[model samples]
Target: MIKVIIIGSGNVAQHLIAAFQDSQNLGSEIELVQVFSRQTTNLSHLLDYDKITDDWNTLAEADLYIIAVSDDAIADVSSQLPFKNRLVVHTSGSVSLNALDDNNRKGVFYPLQTFSKNKAVDFKTIPICLESENATDFQLLDKVAKAISDKVSAINSEQRKALHVAAVFVNNFVNHLYEIGSEICQEHQVPFEILKPLIAETADKIMVLTPEEAQTGPAKRNDTATIEAHEAFLSNENYLTIYKTLTQSIQHNGKKL
Candidate 1:
């Protein structure tokens, strides 16, 4: 059996734990030996055969150690490990595999999806990015990744970093726009719930349509009158500035299409 151990107990840790529990590909062949974290409260909801610990010594018994801690803590947490034979991996997109010491075999198993502790995540649909120093390690990583997801890819460290940046652009920045939209709705006395359908449709259309093709708004239509009207409605200087900049960007980019 491939004895697996998980480090840290944050949002990503919950998702990883659920995936490891639901993994049918490995069946009984793989076992989740233990979970390590500073707090035992995070593991309270988890009720099964596995053990939880605040100590790092438990890592010595596992075959694979997965560091699911924050990006900044990854290197610090990894450097404290006492084992060498176990394959040590991190589930971070922004961090590099070399963050772990060269004394142990290292790899990355980054899941390309946002994880929230309160919001449930669909593990099977999320893409898993796998990378390792050698073919054998990569195969092992691939096996673990594929067991939880069908969308597994062999990405190098640089590509993974690039993807993480792109993800921030698409998910984080876009979500900020949604927050702004909600605030605008509040100020205008417009129902924020009314934007839900449009939001859902915007995401749905992208599944079968390119973002460029699906782009539609005053900017896309070059409706300067509507744009100016919206800008006039925005009392906030920053919002107006963003609206003008984005409109200009869209207009300039739209001409290429």
Candidate 2:
């Protein structure tokens, strides 16, 4: 059995705890022995009070220690681990393997999905990005990852960093665009629900078609009059600048065709 200790009570850490807890069906291949949180109350709702501790010295001896802390705190937290030469990994996309204290066997087990405390996610669908400083530790991480997720890949720190940046563009930036769209709808007294199907279809289309191939808009068609009207219609200077920039990008991309 892989005895695991999770260090954090945030969204990702909570989700991982749930995933490992449910993995008991796999003949208890993965076990959540303990969880460490500075504010033990934060994890009390998820784990038994006995299983949660604020003291680092009380951390149990586990096969792996997964630090799911924030990016800035990873180094400090890992450095504080009392033991050494254990398989210690962090759940971060941007932070490198070097962030962990070298006193332990370092690795990364980054899940390539956005996590929310209220939203329930299927662990099997989330791709687990695994990396290790050595071959033995990599195999161990792979085994643990496979127990909870169906999709797992060996991704280096550099590749993981690139993927993190791309995720910001696709998830974070695209969500911001949705916010702007909702704002525009509110300004015009139009129900934002009216755009739901369009948004769904746009997302579905990209599954089978390249984003460039799926591109459709006044900008893609080089409709200068329509573009100018949109620019003028956007009363907000910031919105107008965004509209012009996107339109130019679409036109430029279309030129390559």
Candidate 3:
């Protein structure tokens, strides 16, 4: 059995712990033996106290140690680990594998998704991106990933970095635009719920059609009059700027296509 210990008690860590525990329950060869948290209480909801540790010294030996800490803390945390020559990895898309301390074998185990502590996600559908210097370690990571996820890829650090930036544009930036839309609705006394179906259809469309093909807006059609009207309707200087910027971007992209 491949024993694994995860460090950190944040969103990604909690989700992974749940996924690994579920795998263990289903008799998968991978076992989640322990979790390291600076405060044991942080992970109490997920695992028994015995399996969670606040002290690093008490960490049990495991075949793999997954560091799920914030990007800034990864190097420091890995440097502090008491053991050496073991397989260690971080779940970061932008951070390079070399950022990990060389005391242990290095790898990346990035799960490309937006995670909130309140929302539960199905691990089987989450694509896991992995990188490692050692082919043997890569195989072990692949096995571990396959135990929970149906989609897994061997991604190098450079490629992973590019993927992360694209993710921010698609997930983070797009979500902010949704917030703007909701704000616009609230300002006009319109129910934000009215836009839910449109939001769902917009997301579902990309599954079948390319984003460019799915595009259907005044900007896409170069309807200059409607675009100017939308810009004029936005009294908020920031929103108005954003509207003009996005409209121009859409028109530029359409022109290129």
Candidate 4:
């Protein structure tokens, strides 16, 4: 079995711990040897107390060490590792492969999806982006990625950076819009639940149709009257700015905003 150790107990780290444990339960050739977290309470529910470590000196040897901490902490965490030459990787979409300390073999095992501690995700459907300096380490990363996900891709630093930007647009930014819509609904005494179907259908349509082909709105029709009404109705300057910006982009046929 390929022995693995994970560092951190944040959202990404917890999700990874669950996915790896699930894979092991299914008889996959992978074993989660241990996990390192500053506060054991954060992960005590997910893993046995014996398997979670708070001290760096007690870290066991493993074939792979996954640093799933925040982006800023990756280098510091890597530098503090007790071992060397092991395949050490970070679960960051924007951070470079070289962010890890030079004492270890660096790689990236970035899962391209937003993670929330309360939200369960199917790793099988999430795309895992792998990057490494050498072919041998990349092969190992690929195997580990495929062990959990059906969609695995060899993404280099530059491409991964671009993908992260696009992900922010599609996932993070879009979610903000949803939050705005929800707030608007609540403010107007409209049930936010009523918009759930529309949201579902909009998301489902993109699965088979191109985003451009699926696009529909007053903006798409260049309905200036509706656009003006929406802009006028939105008393919040931030909302009004975003509405006008998006409308202009749509009317301009996907012009960069």
Candidate 5:
């Protein structure tokens, strides 16, 4: 059995806990030995209270220690681990693998998916980006990743960093645009649900088609009148700047298509 301990109690950690629990049904030998949280109460709802602890010294011996803490806290948390020369990995996309303490074998087990505390995600669909300092450690992470997710890939640190940047643009920035659209709908007393089908269609289109091929908009078509109208309609200076910049990018990039 692959004994595992998860450190931290955030969205990724909670989701991982649930994923590992479900993995047992799939014939996985992974075991959830313990979970570390600064306040055990935070994770008591998701994990057995007995399996959760606040004291780092109380961490059980395990084959793998997965640190799912924030980017800034990963180094501090890994450095404080009592044991050394054990396989330890962090669940971060942007943070480098070297951030972990050298005393332990370091790896990155980044799940390329957005996590929400309330929302339930299917781990099978999420891509697990695995990286390790050595081939042996990579094999272990690959086994554990495949046990939970059908999509697993070995990505180097530089490639992972590039993927993280692209993810921020596609996921985080696009979500912010959705928020802006919602605000616009509220201002006009229009139901945002009206845009649901359009949103769904836009997302679905990219599944088979390249993003460039799927692109369609006033900017892409070089409809300066429509673009200008949109820029004029925005009251916020920040939104106007963003609108113009994106429009310019679309036009410039669309020329190649």
Candidate 6:
């Protein structure tokens, strides 16, 4: 069996563990030998497992070491590992594969999704970005990735970096827009619940249509009167600025109804 050790107790680590457990392909071929964390209390959910550890020494026994810690601490944790030829990998999108200097055979297994401890992920649909130093390692990582996800892609470090930035725009910036809409509803004494359907529809449409094609609203339609009214209704300067900026972006991008 291929022994695997994961380092971290955060949402990513938890999600990864859950994914591994769900993968039938890896059930008999691979085993999760250890889960390392600084504070064991954070990993109470995994207490049933006999392989949980708060110390780095436990990592010595595993054949594959996965540093799922934060981007800043990947190198720190990797450098301390005792095994010289052990295959080491990290689950990060922004951090490059070369970040871990202890081993030259490092790779990245980035899951392109926002993970929260309370929220479960559908690994089957989520994209798994796999990369490694050479063809042999890349093939190994690809096999591991395909076992957990149907949408696995062999993306290099530079492409992975670009995708990470794109993810921030689509996920982070779009969520901020939802927040702004909620705040607007709250301030106007309107139920924020009313916007839920619209938000869901917006996301749903994108699954079947391009964001540019799904674009709607006064800006895309060039309804200046409605745009002016929306700007006038805004009580917060920041909110109005955001609205104006997005409107301009949509209009300048030549989005048509």
What are the Cα lDDT values of the candidates?
0.86, 0.92, 0.94, 0.92, 0.92, 0.82
**C-alpha RMSD by candidate, in order:** 1.7, 1.1, 0.8, 1.7, 1.3, 2.1
- 1-257, model 4: which lDDT tens digit per residue? 88899999999999999999999999999899999999889998999999999999899889899999999999999999987788999999989998889999999999999888778999999999998889999988888888899999999999999999999999999899999999999989999999999999999999999998898889988888998999999999899999989888888874543
What does the lDDT come to for candidate 2? 0.92
How far off is residue 70 in model 2, in Å? 0.6
Candidate 6's error at 153, in angstroms?
Answer: 0.7
The model with the greater lDDT, 2 or 3, is: 3
Cα lDDT over the full model 1: 0.86
158 Cα displacement, candidate 2 (Å) = 0.9
Q: Candidate 5 at residue 214, lDDT?
A: 90
Tens-place lDDT per residue, model 1, 1-257, is: 67788898898987888888788344845667788889878788973534788877654476678899999998888888886656899999989999987768999989999987788877989999998888988887777777788899999999998999999988998999999999999998999999999999999999999989899999999998899899889999988988998999999998876
TM-scores for all candidates: the values are 0.94, 0.97, 0.98, 0.96, 0.96, 0.93
Extract clashing residue pairs from model 4: none
**Global local distance difference test of model 6:** 0.82
Q: What tens-digit string does per-residue lDDT give for candidate 5 at 1-257?
A: 99899998888998999999889766788888899999678787778788998997788999999999999999999999998899999999999999999999999999999998778899999999999999999998998898899999999999999999999999999999999889889989999999999999989999999988898889988998999899889998888988988999998897765
Report the Cα lDDT for candidate 3.
0.94
Pick the winner on lDDT between candidates 1 and 3.
3
Best by lDDT: 3
lDDT for model 4: 0.92
Q: After superposition, how far is residue 146 of candidate 6 from its true place, in Å?
A: 1.8
Clashes of each: 0, 0, 0, 0, 0, 0
lDDT (Cα, 0-100) at 115 in candidate 4: 88
Candidate 1 segments exceeding 4 Å error = 24-28, 48-50
- Candidate 4 root-mean-square deviation in Å: 1.7
lDDT of 3 by residue, 111-167 (tens): 998999889999999999999998999999999999989999999988998999999
Give candidate 5 misplaced runs (Cα > 4 Å): none
